[model samples]
Target: MPTRPLSNEVLQKTIDVYIASMRSWTDSAKKLGIARSTLEHRLKVAKRRGMLGPMPKALDGFEVKEYSEQIGKNGEVKSRSTKYSPEGGGQFEVPDGYKIKGESVLTDADGQIRARWVKTKEGEEDPLQVASVVRGAFEGFVAKSPNIWRLKDHDEDSLTVYPLADFHLGMFAWSKETEGPDWDLKIAERVLTETFQELVERAPKSRKAVILGLGDLMHADSHKNQTPGSGNIMDVDTRYQKVLPKLCDIIIQCTEFVRHKHAEVEAEFKAGNHDPASTVAIRTGLDLYYRNDKHMTVNTSPSPFWWHGFGVNMLCGTHGDGAKIKDLPGIMASYKREMWGSSKSCHAFTGHVHHELCTEKDGTRVYSLRAPIPSDAWHSAEGYLSGRSMYGFHFHKDKGSTGRSEVEIL
Candidate 1:
């Protein structure tokens, strides 16, 4: 028969046998069926750690269920191991700056409960602190001096609207991968700026102009490079820190450009599924940039629905990610009852499908504008394709939609 290896239990028995034999090493080794050297080493370890009789209990708030010690041949303790569990009915407090990742509780056959918790460092930024940082940065920024431009001849009763939808500024798409035109931050900026300049030059000289950002102005809301609500991974052009400031710059440049063309300019950015928080940042940045300018009005509302009344024409807009398109007419009617009741014509605009759709029901005309951005990898792979274009709508105070200008991307 093979002899069993030495353990803490064997060591305790050996200690007792040695004492019973008047501390004789040879007698203890013979009785335990171990080598005399092994008995001597284990005894030295037991004496060194004072663990000769029984294992020590765990400290407060913890219970050591199992204990082990490895001793070397040279009468030295090599290592000690312990398995600890939270005490029964004990509260486990997660350390500061940490969050519980997972937890489990096991009830032993003796009806004693053992609890285990795994914690991870919390990494998400607080929204309030992020907003505070953005607000502070914008507040401290010294805006450039406004360019002095004389007002040109413009039609007082007309309002021109530049609808920018699904610009997807931070998106990245390769021509080979998506089977579409290559797009990135640089291309998007150039295409949108040039398109807006062309549209502005061709459209009628209206006294009031509106820069309407229908939604998805930014591709990803944060550095996670994922859809804000769905958490779907996205192909992004750059980091969020870079994209946000650039987004603000683009809007400011466009607004400044249009300010020179019209007598009064108003801008509103609607929240979208892709960029609910980013829309707030853009609107806040715009408001801060033009707060001193008398000719500019930037709507800083975080509302999902927005409306503007130009004489008898009621212009209503939403991101269109929520609420069925057909239901929008009724929604607008209920939300803007006064405007809907008084207006001669009502027009509602939305952006989400990345394609143009027009429907008129119950006296309200709802148009889903086409996005200027090219199809990304996911859309291309899914066989979703649409012509990329933006529109400029001109409306008269008494008439709804006098004319439209389209800039189609090739």
Candidate 2:
């Protein structure tokens, strides 16, 4: 007798029973009142229809309106296409390995707004994905042999902060075009390392040191050589793969240098408009590299803002691209209420405009540090020139704003 076709509901129920029965063909077949062959055939049909394995589920704040999968000859999923519709007002989610290709909206006669987002398989690896892969590989390599350095003795009451703002690693700038010092990967590494070493040597011997990256650590966020937020084209020095490793190397070098000078070193890299994802990758690498070192603390938080409390002083830092400088004090107070209330002196360090600006509001002083890197082609063409420099601020436990050491690039 020919076998009758089973409905989707029946097939799904069989599959569920089969799974619940621990994938025993005899048990599932008996429970479903079907022959073993019939059960197997139904499973084959379900697999062919892309219903055997985990199906695409609805994303948060959105519902999966449509889902299709391309099956290869070997029964492997070649690609996936999904259409998502927002359940309500808010941002929609994109399925993994998919990118938003197009969007459409329909307005019914009843005046209901229905929007659909078509997402296709992403052809290129996302920057954050690439970072994750690289970070894993790096973690594996560094885990075998951990390097722990000796700590130094220094003043316990003082905390020194090395503010590295807008280093712009991987940026390309010609001296003639930008009317500034020529910069590239090699030059940037040399200038940053050399300048930081000089600053470290000149800085007072504090027990704790903060290597604060005030943002724009990389000229480009990803392989696309464009700003992450604005999508503006950037003048890049080389491929992103090469630049990312070099970024980790520079940070490692700076941290090592600081470790020798201070007993405890805390490193934090903020996400700038250009290198938000890159900063995460860099910090991940740093954390993995220094995971075994008890004296080194790497802040790998994905938050845009970072803060540290030392003695009676509180130091906060941000990329300075989101909130206004004047508003930072209120933000700090609100975000870090305990730290704000306990500390006698509060200071927020920021970098984005690439110039020095010191302003006090509501008892918190916000300082926008200057970048050591010269202006790139875009900034130069726009006549946005500023003095190039880096600074290290020192804070006394009881007294605040003791002094600072500066490195001016001439």
Candidate 3:
């Protein structure tokens, strides 16, 4: 038989178990694949290297049960008598250095019972620390849902949805360097609010409005000026401290404006590559800001995709950074199965390509929105000078899409 090379972890475990068992060297060596003399040498070397520690106090009357059973395809069980081995051993004396920290019972493909366990080194990994790390991930989310206000002369006519993807709010650019209009935090504020106003003005009166903050609403993830997920250095207008409060004010302004025109407003947010964590923070802020006001519903969830419904229309969107266009229709359908099934018309929107694109797959229509923000140095150098634009779709109560309004940046 080919000798399976033992790792340091396994060797240490084996030596510890041998000492704890108080078994003969010959018996332990035969059970393991090594010769009796080799086992003795390894034990001496392990002690010298400080890999073999003092044996743990033996558990009194701790008996281990062992049995084997093979089941046929026809559900006939056959019991077989076999020699007992350790939990992780094939034919060797199983190492007992590590106790069962935790275990989960599972069934494998062959319909056999399997036990999965988390094993740590002796006196390592505090249970309290493990629990604290797991607990830290959850943020207390309570739906302080307020009553939605309807338009005074509200006719269930149409709904307007703005696709505000890839805002990249704190991005910086110089006209002389990029040969395009200069961009910064100030310009971002203007373009987003102004374009949103123009888009709303051009659209028909609606009972409700959706002001979508697609993703990447910030250029830098942290105060140190790095991309959110990639950690790449980015061009920035100012410190995150200066931009954070101002950007939150800008969104509040947009939503407040929308609320005036429509009776109800649903402010939806999607996290982008440039501002994943920031997006969630911004959304949570918005949720708190309008918690008392009943005219708006704030959705600042950190999920990649979101869906909103209007009568017969099902509107879905993603950041467009992770998924391709062709896969979106199926993905949306799969994720929003009940919504997809019930709605007659499905319209999907995405951002991050910076250019506008439209395609139809199956019965779904996918629209890749054009960002209204001006190009930074990298986009300009790469010749990605797609015209800056924003789009708002008007959804009829029963007829699906009636029309769309677009505002362009010169």
Clashing residue pairs for model 3: none
Clashes of 1: 0
Which prediction has more favorable TM-score, 1 or 3? Answer: 1
Off by over 4 Å in 1: 1-151
For each of the candidates, the C-alpha root-mean-square deviation to the true structure, in angstroms, is 22.1, 27.1, 26.2
Tens digits of lDDT, candidate 3, 1-410: 21243345655766865866585787678767778777776665444333543322212221123334677788777544333223232323224444445444454453333343444345456789778877786557543222223347754678989777877878899999899999888878877877776666666668878988878777777797888677788789999988878788878877766787788888888888888778878899999999988878997666788788778999888888888888988987898888888899988898898898899999899888888888888889989988888788889879998879888888
Candidate 1 lDDT score relative to the true structure: 0.82
> Each candidate's TM vs. the true structure?
0.63, 0.63, 0.62
Model 2 misses residue 74 by how many Å?
99
Count the clashes in each prediction: 0, 0, 0
lDDT score for residue 175 of model 3 = 95
lDDT of 2 by residue, 283-318 (tens): 889999999999999988888898988778988999
Model 3 CA lDDT for position 149: 39
Poorly placed runs, candidate 3 (over 4 Å): 1-151
Lowest summed lDDT across 10 adjacent residues in model 1 is found at: 1-10
Cα lDDT of model 2 overall? 0.83
